[model samples]
Target: MSLEIRIAASTDAEAACNVLRRSIRECCELDHKNDPAILDAWLGNKTPQMVANWFSSPTNFSLVAVSEGVVVGVALLTGAGKLALCYLLPEARGQGAGKALLARMEEQACSWGVKALQLHSTATGKDFFAQRGYTDAGMVRSPYGVETVFYWKQLDEDTTCPNAPKRKRFCNCNSD
Candidate 1:
C-alpha cells in the first residue's frame, strides 16, 4: 500500500468515519465484544457529521491515512494535548499506517509546543501505545460502562520513536 498522511478536511469525514467504525468494531472488538448497546454508545461520536465538526473546530485537528486514494486510517489530536483518537481499519494495521499517522500527530503537537500527550485506549491498543513510549496511568470506566485505559507520554526532543520513518508521504492537504 502506498500510504500518505495529511490533515483531514470536512469532506474527508465520511471516509474517515468508515475507517473509525471498522477500527472500533473489528480491530478493537476485544474491548467492546458483540454487545450491541456498548457498540452503539461507544461509536456514537464516530459519525461523519461529528468528524466534520472535528475538522472545523479550532480546538481539534485530524489526520487521515490514505492508501491508493482511500482513507484507511485516522488520528485526531486536540489543542489541549490530547490524542483524541487514533484508529485504523484491520487491513491498514501492521503496515506502518498507524505509526505514520501517529508520528505526524506527535510532530504537529510538538510543533505547537505541547509538552504532553494523552489518550484513552482499549485493552487491545494499550500495548501499541506503550511500545511507542506512552506510560499507563491506570484504567477508568466510561460513563457508558466501558473500561478504558489511560496512557500519557511526556513530550521532549526525543519523544518520537526511532522506528518511525521520515514523513515523505505527506499530502498537499497538510497545510492548514
Candidate 2:
C-alpha cells in the first residue's frame, strides 16, 4: 500500500518513538557505529511520553508516515524553524516516505510564516538534504556528541516545487 502522511496523534507516540529509535540504530550506523555510550545518549530522551509531548506541543508540528496501518516514519518541525526530527524505518527507506515527510514539513513551515528551516543531518542524510536545496552551513556536535552536518534552506514565498525529471519509480533517492 502507498504511504500516508498525516499529523501525529497522541496515540501514535509509541509507534513513532519506535520508528525514531530504530531509524537511528539501523540507518545511522555511520554515526553511532554501534557505540553503546553514543547510542544510549542519543536515545535517552526518546521515550513514548516524550514523543507524545513533542507531538502535542503548541510550538511544534509533528507528522507520521503510515503504511499498511503501521507507523513507519516520523518528523517534527519546530516553530523556530528547525527540522528537529525526521526518521524512517529501515524497511520503509527507499519508498518515497522521507521525501513526502520533508515536503510536508516544508509546506507546514511556509504556512506558519517560517522563512527558513535549519537542521542537523547525519552522514546518511547529508546528500538527501543537499539535493532538496539545503545548504551546508557548518558542523556541530549533536546533543549526544555525534558530529553532525548543519544545513539551512531558505524557503520561497510561493512554496511551489520546482520541476524535475520524472523518476521511473518512487525510491527515496536523491537522484533517479
Best candidate (score: lDDT)? 2
Give the per-residue lDDT digits (tens) of candidate 1, residues 115-167: 78999988888889999989999998876567989999887765453333334
In candidate 2, what are the lDDT values of residues 1-176, reduced to their tens digit?
58899999999999999999999999999999999999999999999999999999999999999999999999999999999999999999989999999999988887777778999999989999999999999999998989999999998764432332223656886774
Q: How close is candidate 2 to the true structure, as a TM-score?
A: 0.89
Clashes of each: 0, 0
Q: What's each prediction's TM-score?
A: 0.88, 0.89
Model 1 residue runs over 4 Å out of place are 158-176
lDDT, candidate 2, at 167: 34
Cα RMSD, each candidate = 9.4, 10.2
Which window of ten consecutive residues has the lowest lDDT sum in model 2? 158-167
